[model samples]
Target: MLEQYVRKILTARVYDVAEETPLQSAYQLSQRLGNSILLKREDLQPVFSFKIRGAYNKIAQLSEAEKARGVVTASAGNHAQGVALAAKHLGIKATIVMPKTTPEIKVKAVRARGARVVLHGDAFPESLAHSLRLVEEKGFVYIHPYDDPDVIAGQGTVAMEILRQHQGALHAVFVPCGGGGLIAGVAAYIKYVRPEIKVIGVEPEDSNCLQAAMAAGERVSLPQVGLFADGVAVSQIGEHTFAVCRDYVDEVITVSSDEICAAMKDIYDDTRSITEPSGALAVAGIKKYVARSAIKDQNLVAIDSGANVNFDRLRHVAERAELGEQREAIIAVTIPENPGSFKRFCEAIGKRQITEFNYRFHSKEQAHIFVGVQTHPELDPRSELLKQLDEAGFPVIDLTENELAKLHIRHMVGGHNDAVINERLYRFEFPERPGALFNFLNKLGGHWNISMFHYRNHGAAEGRVLAALQVPDDEMHLVPEAFNSIGYPYWDETDNPAYKLFLAQ
Candidate 1:
């Protein structure tokens, strides 16, 4: 079977549409990991993905009769673009059935390639079912995204290019696994040509079809799949692809969504190019492998599969990147509720950057503060920070790995605090510097109780803060005077409808 795949890969006709992407060296990642890291730039294909290789190969080899009958396929992402472009190049009528929920940009891209677009259900499965129906009704040849032998063979060409590009002492190659087609193809080719090199597969933890199949010793379907890395979000591995992978692939690694975000940032920092979550899987897997094995001075390769990410998703990616890299620590700390306690806590925290700060005056004895602090993976780890906080007599709860805290709790920290009375909410913009929060707290002083406070560093020139202070009715006139003395831009949000609806006491 391996030999047959090897022969097909060598003769694969993908070049008519897909270009041989470069295996570029990742300098910063190499230096950080102590390994020679290289990235297979499959994201640079004409359709901005490796799916083009397989799609073109499958369509180009069809019989004249089949071509005349036309082709149909279902995809909500890169595969849709790949099939559309390939069929257009081959002068064959291609009908692409995509989920109605798919981004308009993607639908436009397929239609731009001259494929008749059929917007079906809200998800891929529904689109796939509709496409199959079209195949039977219209006599259209259905193009399997990752299951067909021709498709797998075309994807194998990626491994062929890698071996030819860098004919050296390669240790292992990391490939992102979806329906297993890309890895199956690359694994078969590599195992046949250079059996010494390990072919490792990477998958999102929530969408690990290959790993589950390998464990079950057969194809096992997941009840549901995660859509974060939508390109590789397969519930079950393809039968043909899995057959090849079961023997050829060495190991599979699963990574969290945060790790994928971190890997995407790493790719962007090195290549100045962004990748979709799935495209960063191989890189994320390589990071975990290096950390686990502690291997050094070995050649590692990561397949960057695609670059079809939406623009709005970058905010979420950036927010989680530091945490994924173990460079940020989130903790809930208990401090004294007395005046100047915020300043004291900052002093205990030392000079390390505070990424986030949230506090609400709940009791006179103690205060709960949700804080995000920056830490280095090697020099000043999260454990050391926790130790420092403990030594300072500050009770702390590590929320670094708490998905609930990270995703929702952080934003919902201070809402409708009935204990907060006579609260005057004010929004401030302070100079974004190391001691800015401490300085602001010091100026605000022990005069009044701080009812609610929130500060998040957004890497902007100025840090945005929302704080509410408790003051007597007579001291209302002094509020503006105190803020003016602090010398920072401020706005009174006491009557802001959003505050009244969500947070007013």
Candidate 2:
């Protein structure tokens, strides 16, 4: 069988190539999973990925004539760097055609390794097509990212290392699946060496090409690929890689983008290394599988595949991580548009910090406001808060359950209020501890009324409170003076662009 041949090659070549990555036991994950859990640290490889092993092995196995002719490949990021560095080591010319949207860091890394870089097309498929055309035009050898046997055998080395390190004690291995190359290689080697060790492939639910292909009994193409996990956002699995996966992989599971982000954050918290969403797949998969299967006493291994993520993207990851874990909730509360009704609602939410508050008074009949609240980690407090709101006769809609809340409504809050003729907007920088906002509210005295307010507690040096205060026309200048007396820096929003933009909306 092909598994035997793959094992033989993996044992001989892959071990010789990528022998340095560690199979480190994760103390945090093992405790959480209720069994021994180990992380195969492929992210620690020189290229920050396992791609170099496959790319180098594939290039090395090519004939002397092929090496003389040079090679060309297409990748969104990591694979391009791998092939570029490998070709540079072999002293052969290499061309990498990448998507125009590829991160600047990746493009620079590929060029630094002496590969000619071409930015073509909007996505990976178009870049792959362009690379194929280049191969035809320039007569350079085409090195596929995952399809070839040499590449599969090279990736098999990861499984070889895991087996050698764990010595057959592992119950299951979680591998991230893209074009199916990584899982295919790992599954083939593990099934050959230790048939009892289950090999499972993890994929983003948005791009489960392998799962769909397995069900259809043929290679299947998704209509669209999600770019969030650009590393493994392949639309279709390769034929050879799919065959290996079908034969050896025990099961394929899918996880959400939020889950992937949370998993990536977990990995970062434990290892202090940022993992790309694709790299976090194995961790996300294990989480999903454990939750669904209710298996508490089984040893598992999750492969931490790559760490080539853009630093700026971490903001988005952190934002969604809580949502993935169900720690933070976005909700809307419909309160009576009266004077103390808002205050009563605020009082009802004792101790719970309001992450966001958006209000609009459409007419005298109704006042609708969307609120996002951050609760304690245990969601029981949220449940109690909800019950209290219900008892107070306020209609609450859990915007956390609404897609619009998650995507747009939470950010789109402030708007112009023509009725606020006597009101002024002020931006206050205050400390983020509990009761800070309430303390500021209490200090306002009976003279000023809060007509509108927006505040979200981000763990920063300080908390920003955007509030619209309605005071007597004569008392307008007292706003800043009062805040300054209390040691709070206040900025008038009359000339601020962000204030105007929010108000104009």
Candidate 3:
């Protein structure tokens, strides 16, 4: 079965538009990790992603009758552009169905590639359902993003290119896994040709379909996927891709969102390229793998998959990268409200640059300061600094690894305590669309009074809401039912340390 895929990959017709991207050296990262690192620059494609290779390959094999009918596919981002570009080149009409929650930048990009864009569904699964309907109704050929044999074979060309580019003894190759198309293709080819070179699949911890599939010994559908790495936010692994990975891929590494952001910064620092979160998955995996094994002095390669990032998303990446890499530490310190107390605290911090500092006069005796302190990558300097403050009888809380504090509470301080009773806080994530908030309120807020609300758009597929509600003891039991009826996943943030410190009742 694997040998058949190897032969097909060798003959995949992708060079018509997809160029063989360079496998360049990442010297800075190599030096840091004590290993020679090579980055497979798939982001350099004309379509700015590796999807073009697979999309074109699948469409190129179409019969004349199929070409006449044209092609249709559902994708929220890169795959849509790939199919559109391929369709344009072959003079075949293409229609792309995308989630309405897809960023405007991506929607515009698909249209620019000469494809008719259909905005439907709030998420990928919904868009996929709509696209499948088009296939039955209009008789259009559906170019699946990753599952098809031809698509997997086309993506396998990446491995072919990598083997040809480097003649050295390669230790391992890391590929980012979404629907598992790229890794399946790459693994099929690599395992056949260079069996010793491990092909590791990398995924976001929240969207780890490949990992789950491997563990279950079958394809498993995830209940939900993280949107931060939108490119690889797939809930289920493709059946064909999973079969290849299970037999060929060595391991699947899952990294946190912050780790991905840190990897993005690393890529930017080494090659001056800012990759999307999914694109940086392999890099993040490499760092995690090296940390796990403490492996060094070997040649490791990572596929830098795509670069189609929205301009506005960079700000969030920049803010989180330092913390992701442990180059900065966020600490909440409580010091006396006296004038000399501020000076004493600053003196203890020494010469390290303060990334952020926020404080407000809460009382006459004490004030809480949300501080960001710079630290080295090798050692956590926050520990020693924290000890000094603790010995001096200052209260401190390390907010470095706190997700809630990082996401919502950091931006929210100094607005706590109210006359309104039973202030229950819940963090809600809902599909962002017109009147989404109105719908949320109408569905879940008629019986309860909203006490506090905080929302800021990140220009992604979903919106996050942090709200305080006044729910009586009797109504507390109904809270779960109300949220269930509303159909949005939520976390009770009322007991969170940051909430307790800053805004709890």
Name the candidate that leads on lDDT. 3
- How many steric clashes does model 2 contain? 1
User: lDDT, candidate 2, residue 364?
Assistant: 75
Error of 1 at 431 (Å): 40
- Show where candidate 2 strays beyond 4 Å: 11-19, 375-388, 415-505
User: 1-505, model 1: which lDDT tens digit per residue?
Assistant: 9999999999999998899999999999999999999999999999999999999999998999999999999998889999999999999999999877677778899999999999887567899999999999999999999999999999999999999998999999999999988999999999999999999999999899999999999999997676678899899999999999999899999999899999999999899999999999999999999999999999999999999887877887899999999999988888887888888888888999999988776567877778999999998899999998899889888888865466545785664677778898777866554567998988886668887777765433345677789988999998888898887777787875445534578
Query: Which candidate order results from sorting by TM-score in descending order?
Result: 3, 1, 2
What would the TM-scores of all predictions be? 0.83, 0.79, 0.97
Candidate 3 Cα outliers beyond 4 Å, as residue runs: none
Model 1 residue 115 lDDT? 98
Please tell me which model should have the higher lDDT, number 2 or number 3.
3
What are the Cα lDDT values of the candidates? 0.89, 0.77, 0.90
Alpha carbon lDDT at 431, candidate 1? 51
Q: Tell me the spans in candidate 1 whose CA falls farther than 4 Å from its real position.
A: 415-505
User: Which is the better candidate, 1 or 2, if ranked by TM-score?
Assistant: 1
Clashing pairs in 2: 416-503
Model 1, position 43, has a per-residue lDDT of: 96
